[model samples]
Target: MAGVAGNQPLYICRNCKNPIALRSDLLSKAFIGKYGPAYMFSHAMNIIAGQKEDRKLITGAYSVADIYCCNCGEILGWKYLRAYEMQQKSKEGKFIIETAKIAKEY
Candidate 1:
């Protein structure tokens, strides 16, 4: 959490339970990428899998703020952007060290 960012280099997909390791430089882009950005995240994060039933979704669609499920490609969680209000309140007057750590790689 000193140099890169604290997102955990590895996270088990909550959907399929697959090991989701952060890819190297090539696809380091942050939409489900290594350096997660604000837009790639969803305010409401959850995991689910289902097919379309009668032209409708089997698993009601949800959202995530930060990461995605490596197995099912479903959104898993979210991160509070610096501009996000709730985070500002929680981390108010605190220092944020923007660096990558074992728990936050991708």
Candidate 2:
């Protein structure tokens, strides 16, 4: 949070208003989640990653962990721990945050 520019927008937890990610860290808005549209981010903050598990996502099989808002305990999204396929390896270490779980704060 400290490195973010003062004017940069933020994505905050809808339930707790805790700063979750910076707009500059957003990588893509074309991702999908369990509920609906999701986003991929290069980095996230104020979050707690749950247990890692192997899940077959739309893209492929991956080791992911559900991320929660540290302040409110709301399930925000999942972080990609590992990608089984070579083509999907680029997604490793990235964050997938559901659009419905976060809001933009300008």
The all-Cα superposition gives candidate 1 an RMSD in Å to the true structure of: 13.9
lDDT of 1 by residue, 1-106 (tens): 2123245353334445454333221222233223433122111212332331221112222221334443476554333223333422332221111123112334
Summarize candidate 2's per-residue lDDT along 5-68 as a digit string, tens digits. 4879999999988999999999999999989999999999999999999999999999999999
List TM-score per model, in order.
Answer: 0.25, 0.95
lDDT of each: 0.30, 0.95
The regions of model 2 sitting more than 4 angstroms off are 1-5
Root-mean-square deviation of every model: 13.9, 1.7
